[model samples]
Target: MNLPPVNIENIDIKLRFGNFVLNVLYVKFGYFLSSMPEHSHSQGSYELHYIPQGKGTLIAQDQSYPITPGTLFMTGPDIIHEQIPDFNDPMAEYCIFFEVLPGDSTPAINRNHIANDRLMSELLMSTPFWIGTDRENMMALFEMLASELSIQSVGFHHTVTNILEIIVIRLVRQYSLHTSSLHPVPLKTLDDSRLLTIENCFLYQYPSITLKKLADNLRLSTRQTERAVRKQYGISFSEKKAQVRMSAASRLLLSTELSIYAIAVQIGYTSQEQFSNAFKRYYGMTATQYKFKRI
Candidate 1:
């Protein structure tokens, strides 16, 4: 019997941002047969599979679930799983592999007193094994990844890393919303009314995101929005945003070979000198210093 290849080195990327680093192993959109044998992913790795168009049964941890379009499954660490594609029918899907460490934002995690501190820390560790997603949103993200991977163009990996972060945010949002309906108080802590939604928008559009855009989305005055951020996070909106950008910059410095100038442009800084100053203020070291030290 022919077995699917598991060459992780070819596609794997050491993706990093903030306090998070993801070892993205592989992604494929194709047919996978199950006649071979059951297998578990390596320790410290994760596998996310999305069935965009298919009929199959996913057997994991001795439980079986039917797979259909928009079905997304997540497995972290060592968990036995195997896919059984329908014998006679075509099974098409997208599978992603990666490993995340301490899946929390940089300083937010350091501030353990914050409301969502536990929530963000537990995001990847506590992900559900399988989930049903909004078909359109899920498929759009998968397709975008597929398109980028197919092209392997300039900055494709960067694009993929950004989209992967967005995907994680969406998953967390859905999970939190669902859990909130069952238990309201935790959601209230993680989200201050509609403010969490706004925060997620910032995460999705960071670096280039503008306060005016967030205010427009919420139909709130800029001052009102700023007030909400301070109320929720205990910091001004600009400070929080700079933290996010610097987090991204630091990750780029350590993980990628990009120059300080390129990293600055990617994170919305206009000049390398300006970005370098911010880096020093946030990290207490020059970007070049950080990069070489990490090396």
Candidate 2:
């Protein structure tokens, strides 16, 4: 699909630990049928490339990496890179160019938070080049961005900004996984975005997720984590977790033919009996009854 290029001059993007202002130079989506000449970004600039289909080769500073469907890579400041698509199966790509800038002001609540952001920024800046496959399944996000830009519906700009921010965060996460030394430190304050990330853990990682795991992910103490969840969601952590799991379970029951035991396991319940009891308490109907009633 043809997507109009998006140019964002200056916008603040919230990261896991802190925020950064960025200029999104452009976003492009197309099947690269022609080779791109070797180019390097200016200082503080990065170009992210995602290939959703076909094959290509990326040559970065004399090193070549095979690019296939689901390939993702980034060329940062001063990294020479060239793209050559295979003629037999030209690669479709989603490319984003942006320059990261320092935030206007850093909060004074915790020096550690600032340090964490700095550490992440430094990591990104120091790594001039990286090539890897997409682990976050960002094709859907790129498609959504393209759709929003093409349609230009009400609030499209806001939606586009949010999607771009998420793309940046997921990119950072990919880098963090490779750099074992990088770690999240406890923050003195939790912002709404960070709180939402914490809440989404229950949605995405409900199975085998724990309070300690959530606390560690936030780099906060368990008590502080619980307080944050309650403060933002107006409910206890367990209640919120149940709400997410039950909602998911209900969908599974209605949408799929999975057995109750399987659905219970999928949603982190130890047994069908336990899941049934919880579902009944939450929805006033047994698992089977709910399924049949909906049917």
Taking all chains together, each candidate's TM-score versus the true structure is 0.50, 0.54
> All predictions: root-mean-square deviation over Cα?
18.2, 18.7
Which prediction has the highest TM-score against the true structure? Answer: 2
For model 1, what is the error of residue 66's alpha carbon versus the real structure, in angstroms, after optimal superposition? 0.7
Off by over 4 Å in 2: 1-19, 108-116, 176-295
Question: What is each predicted model's overall lDDT from 0 to 1?
Answer: 0.63, 0.71
Which 10 consecutive positions of candidate 1 have the poorest summed lDDT? 180-189
lDDT of 1 at 219: 75
The residue-by-residue lDDT of candidate 1 on 124-174, one tens digit each, is: 555535466543387788778778777769999789778776776565555
Residue 87 accuracy (lDDT) in model 1: 73
Report the Cα lDDT for residue 153, model 2: 92
Clashing pairs in 2: none
Question: Model 2: which ten-residue window has the lowest total lDDT?
Answer: 179-188
lDDT of 2 by residue, 1-295 (tens): 4344544322333323356555565677787777765544434556888888899899887678999989989887556566889999988888877656556565747889788677666666666677787889898999898888777799987888889878877876787433322222223245434544563475467677788888988888999888876654456779877876886777678768999999999889998899999999999989999999945
